[model samples]
Target: MKVLVTGAAGSIGRVVTPGLAERGHTVVGLDRVPQPDGEDGAWYTVDCTDPDAVAAVFDEESLDAVVHLAGHPDEASLPDSLSSHVVTTAALLDAVHEHGVTRFVYASSNHAVGRTPRTDLLTVATRPRPDTFYGVGKVAAEALLSLYADRYGLDAVACRIGSFLERPETLRQLATWLSHGDCVRMVEAALTAPAPGFTVLYGISANTRAWWDLEPGRALGFEPQDDAEAYADSVAPDAPEDVEVDCVGGPFTSTAYERPALDRSS
Candidate 1:
């Protein structure tokens, strides 16, 4: 299958591109800027908010799947993040659906449901309680997944991904961290699963401290191999003292969530 991965040079994009290549997919990596050391897949410099740029790629590539990872990972000065996350996603979805792409794997976020209490188990059934504008963008993008699938017959999956760092960087991450390998496996499942209508999968590993439900992802064929428990003892970093530690979104739920984040690579 020929696959196009937007944000292919960003933190998560760098890893996902090569993984798809290893799986025998013809991968095309697109980014806002050329990566100094991009992967072996074909690379294209693209700005997701620019419909002309996105359309240029679609006109040239006969894509089978799209792993839409292009977006600002956190809240920004309103219009920029809005145009980048929401508008960019809309453009990509239009192109994918119009071109008859078979599979679309949207990189949604845990922040979409950040305010849900921790005592209640998090599942696909949980309603989105977006804690920030960034979270709102993710929720809006997810709505596109459902629309595209229902109206255009696309097999799409929106993954409300958790902390996708290289490792469990903080104590809060012990429960939210998604291992790099496990993330690749999840995308593999999305790309290969048979007739996956439209669904939501919480992107998390098999962690002992996991608060999100894994059954939905498992049913879609995502078998996570890594666990955050391995690093719990050394999980020295933590979220801000004022931030609530009980929710699924961690720091993102705080009003002080002004930090600029990278993509949800997991």
Candidate 2:
């Protein structure tokens, strides 16, 4: 399968781009920044929000799937969040539709359902309770993907990724950390899953204390291999217990997120 990975220069992209190639897929990278040195694969520098530029990439390469990871990585003003996440997603979805791409694997975040209390295990069927403007953008993007899938018969998979890190550093991370190896595995499964139409998956590892259910991902052949429990003794000892323990969104749902919804300064 030929895959196009947006945000190929970012942290997750850096791991996923080459990782996909190692799994027998042809990878074509697209990002706003230039491809880093020593990175192997065909790459294109373009902002995903620009429909024409994104279309040009599709025109040039016959892609089979898209792993969309380009977007604002943190909480921001509502308009900025929408433009970064929703607008970029719309452009790519349009291009995917214009061409004959069959699969769309979005890098949606857990923040989409962050406001949900950590009272029970989270499942894909859980109602969306976005914690911030950034979270709202993710929810909106997922809705758009659903619309395109139903109308166009596309196989769209929204991955609600947890804390993607090299290792667990906090008490929450022990339950939420998505290992680098497992990140690649999750994407591979989503890309290769047979006819998974409009699916929602939690991108996490096989942790012993996971907050989100992994059954949905397993149903799609995403068997996560890593466990964050190994680091529990080390991290849990020093980790601070805070508001994050109250909800699945962690600190994102706290008073700190209550700020201006727009940035007026130029």
Candidate 3:
């Protein structure tokens, strides 16, 4: 399969782009930044929000699928969030629809359900309860994907990724960490899953302390192998007890995340 990965220079992209190639997929990288050294496959420097630029790529490459990893990586004003997440997504989806691409795999975040209390395991069926504007953007993007799936028969998969890190660094991470290897595995599964129409999967490892359910991912042939439990003893001794672990969103649901919707000073 030929895959186009947006944000190919970002942290997750750096890992996923090469990892996909290793798994026998042809990877084409797209990002605003110049292609980094040692990146395997073709690379295009373009912001994903520009429909024309994005369309040109579709015109050039016979892409089988897209793993959308671009967008604002943190909380911001509502408008900025929408432009970064929703607008970028819309442009790609339009191109995907126009070019007959079969599948789209989005790097959605767990913040889409961050405000939900961590009383029970979170499933893809959980209602949207975004804890921040960043979360809201993810939810909106997911909705747009669903619309495309329903109307155009696009196979879209939204991966609500947890803490994607080298390893568990904090108490919250012990439950939420998505190992680099598992991250690649999750994306591969999303890209290759047979006819998964508008599916949602939590992007995390096989952690013993996981708060999110993995059955949905497993159903799609995503069998994550890493467990954060190995590093628990090293991280738990200094774990802080606070709002970070109180909900699926951790600190994103706390008062610290509250801010003016607009930054007029600029």
- lDDT for each residue of candidate 1 in 1-266, tens digit (9 for 90 to 100): 89999988777887788888888889998889986462465778989898888888999999999999988877775566678778998889888877878799989999999988787568889888987778878888888788888998889999888989888867778888898899899988988888999989989899888888999899989999999999887765544353546676777777677554444447
Q: Model 3, 170-265: lDDT tens per residue?
A: 898888999999999999999988999999999999999999999999989999999999998788655656787889899898898998877888
Q: What is the TM-score of each predicted model, taking all chains together?
A: 0.92, 0.98, 0.97
How would you encode candidate 2's per-residue C-alpha lDDT over 135-250 as one tens digit per residue? Answer: 99999999999999999999999999999999989888888899999999999999999999999999999999999999999999999999999888788554655775889999
Winner on lDDT (1 vs 3): 3
Clashing pairs in 1: none
Poorest stretch of ten by lDDT in candidate 3:
236-245
List residue ranges in candidate 1 displaced over 4 A.
237-244, 258-266
Clashing pairs in 2: none
Q: How big is the RMSD of model 2?
A: 1.2
TM-score of candidate 1 relative to the true fold:
0.92
What TM-score would candidate 2 get against the native? Answer: 0.98
Backbone collision tally, model 2: 0
lDDT of each: 0.84, 0.94, 0.94
Give the lowest summed-lDDT range of ten residues in model 1: 235-244
